[model samples]
Target: MSSQLLSEDFAENIVTTARTATGDSLRSVTYFTRSDFDQLYLRDDLEQDADLNTFVGHEWRGYRETQNAYQESELGQCKFTVRSFENGYLLRVAEDRRGVLITTDGLSMQSYEEIAEALKRMLQDADDEEA
Candidate 1:
């Protein structure tokens, strides 16, 4: 575990919540802070040795940029971001300097919203605890 800000139990709980909501289609769950990240869960079929450092760097930058991404628009602050791939979807939710990156197989739009809302609340709760 590469955790620095998140407790092991809390990180696992985050993964559990995602898994329960997304079911078997959930591919991976990663908990990340501004500078470090932990892979809480990954499906057995995937390669474990992939370069996560690069990915984490990209995600951290994305999280920071998203904060002010749409300040001039009426859509409000970003609740989350979803990136679609040919095989699956990547959902990201961030609060303050921490976030969770969830990857899952194709799921309904409702499923994505449900999980994103739940994760946003959880991340906000965690941020509140830190404050």
Candidate 2:
């Protein structure tokens, strides 16, 4: 069995989990992963203004579905839905059968790199534990 914990602050949100070992182990191994969603003003070069509304609209729709699930399950705080005004993007991180899935729309190259790094770390940890 695996368990999860979700947390958030003004600047970032995180999800950590303890996964059960397949065979036999007294203690389950734990791993941590996180995402940061920050708001920023529109920038002319990026056409941030036009894109912001589109992303925001999508986020609102997604948020409602997520919130409903949380409310029904009584796991509201464990889920997160965030919009980044500065970057004109919407980010969502949710648990899935395979593991954690982090998806982003309208994210800059730099932001994508950061997210990739976090995912890589989680994968590395899981691989190391299995070795």
Candidate 3:
């Protein structure tokens, strides 16, 4: 686990991609702020949803600790992991049987396909720039 600050432009793309991919309404797509991540606690609004709470529990404890610690202690740090497709950089947030959360920004996703595509696009753009 590691933390990296995204440029505003890149962050915007990430948010847009996530929104488009998930078909999430603009208002429902909440961006994670530093404080939000720092707390390592799910938002009550999110927790209150009956559909989502089924997956919420102690399982998130480890992820919370790892993410919170990384955010606090590591700056510009990232985890390099091979996603299933093995085709792009994966900015994974959390994963479970229900869904996955990920982003180049701080957006969360419940769709694995969306996560993979957004990550693929983000990584491709980065590669193009490097070249």
Residues 1-131, candidate 3, lDDT per residue (tens digit)? 11234455655565566556644322222223322321121223333343323222322444465556676564643232223323222234342211123322233444544555565556566547756
1-131: candidate 1 lDDT, tens digit per residue: 44556777787779889988999999998888877888888999988997878987798798788776776778877888899999889998887778889999998988999999999989888878878
Candidate 1, superposed: residue stretches over 4 Å from native: 1-5
What is the total number of backbone clashes in candidate 3?
A: 0
RMSD (CA, Å), each prediction: 1.6, 15.5, 12.5
Clashing pairs in 3: none
Which candidate tops TM-score?
1
What's the C-alpha lDDT at position 22 in model 3?
A: 43
TM-score of each: 0.92, 0.27, 0.34
What is the C-alpha RMSD, rounded to one decimal, of candidate 3?
Answer: 12.5
> Between candidates 2 and 3, which one is better according to TM-score?
3
How many angstroms is residue 22 displaced in model 2 relative to the true structure, after the best TM-score fit? Answer: 38
Candidate 3 — what's its lDDT? Answer: 0.39
Ranking by TM-score: 1, 3, 2
> Global lDDT for candidate 1?
0.85
Ranking the candidates on lDDT from highest down gives 1, 3, 2
Predicted candidate 2 versus true structure: per-residue lDDT over 1-131, tens digit per residue: 12333223211222222111111111112122222222321222333234433443454456456656676575544343434545343434333211233323354555544554554455455456656
